[model samples]
Target: MQQIAIAQAAEGMVLAKDVETGDNRILCGKGTALSAAIIERFRRMDISHITVEGHPVVEEGAKSLKEELLDVENRFSKVRHIKPLLYLKKRIQERLIASRRPQPAAKSEGS
Candidate 1:
C-alpha cells in the first residue's frame, strides 16, 4: 500500500491505502478522515491559518496543513500543540515500520 509521506500530506486529503502490517495490524489505515473537527475548533478559536495533516512545512509562500495546524495549535492553545501532533504522526509511522519488520515465528505468534 502506497501512502503519501507526512511531508506530502494535506488537510481534507484522504489516505490512499491502509497503513498496516502484513498480519493486518493497522497503525494508520486508509480512508481515515482528516480531523475536520480540529479545523472547526481552530476556526472557532479565531485562527485563520489552517493546516491539514500530512503536508510539508513551507517557510513562507504558503503554509501546508501541518504548518497551519501547528500555527493554530501552538499559538492559541496552552495545552494542545503542534508537538503532540508531530509526535503522534511519528509514532504512527514507527508502528507501521515495526509492523513491517520480519519477526521470528515466536515473536510473530506472540504478536
Candidate 2:
C-alpha cells in the first residue's frame, strides 16, 4: 500500500493511500486543513473507503479562521437586538414617571 503525504494533497482529490484489514482506521488517519474540508465533502458523498494521513494545517490557516470567526461574532451581536431592550426599558420608565406627575391647570384669561 502506498502512503500519501498531505503536502501533495489537494481539496476534492481522492487519496491514494490504503487501509490495512483489522486496523483501527479512524485512529490511523491524520488530516490536513485541505483534507478536512475534502473529507467532509467526501463523507457527505458517502465515500469513506480511503485512508488519509497528516494533521490539519490549522495553525497555518488560523489567521483567516480567526478573522472569519470574529466577523460572525460581530454579526450575531448586531442581530441580537440587545440595545433595543435597554431603550424600551428607558422609554417605559420615562412614560411611567410622566403619568405619575400632576399636570398644572391653565390660568383663566380674566384672572
Candidate 3:
C-alpha cells in the first residue's frame, strides 16, 4: 500500500486503510474504490492524504525488473565463463526478481 496526497488520489483506486477525520471519525472505510466526486469531497474536508492499495504510482527514471536484471547480467558478463560467478549472478537475479514482486502489507494493530 502507498500513502499518497489527496491530489494524487485517482478514481478507482482502493483504500488500503480507513480514512479518518482529525477527530478519528472514519470518512471512508478500507477497501473503498474511490470515485471522482468522493475524492473532491475529501479535498473539501481538508483530508491531506490517504493510504491506497498497491504501488500504482511509477516514478520517472525507475528501472523495471527486466531492466535491472539485464544490468546485473551485463556487470557480470566478463566473468560469465567462471562457474562460481555464473552461480552468483543467477542468485542475484533471483533475489532481484523476488524483491520486485509485491509484498503483503503488514497488518496493523487496529485491524
Task: List per-prediction Cα lDDT, in the order shown.
Answer: 0.43, 0.40, 0.79
> lDDT: which candidate is best?
3
Model 1: clashing residue pairs? 9-54, 9-55, 11-52, 51-65, 52-65
TM-score of each: 0.25, 0.24, 0.56
Mind sharing the TM-score for model 2?
A: 0.24
Instruction: Give one digit per residue, the lDDT tens place, for model 2 in 2-107.
Output: 1334343445332324332345343222222224555455455444455332222234443443455455455455445688765654565555445333333222
Better of 1 and 3 by lDDT: 3
Error of 2 at 63 (Å): 57
> What C-alpha lDDT does candidate 3 achieve relative to the native structure?
0.79
lDDT of 3 at 52: 82
lDDT of 1 at 46: 44
**Candidate 3 on 1-111: residue-level lDDT in tens?**
677899898877778889998999998888777878779989999999898876666657977778989999899989958999899999999887765454444433233
Worst 10 residues of 2 by lDDT: 102-111
Candidate 1 lDDT tens digits, 49-72: 322223324344854445545555
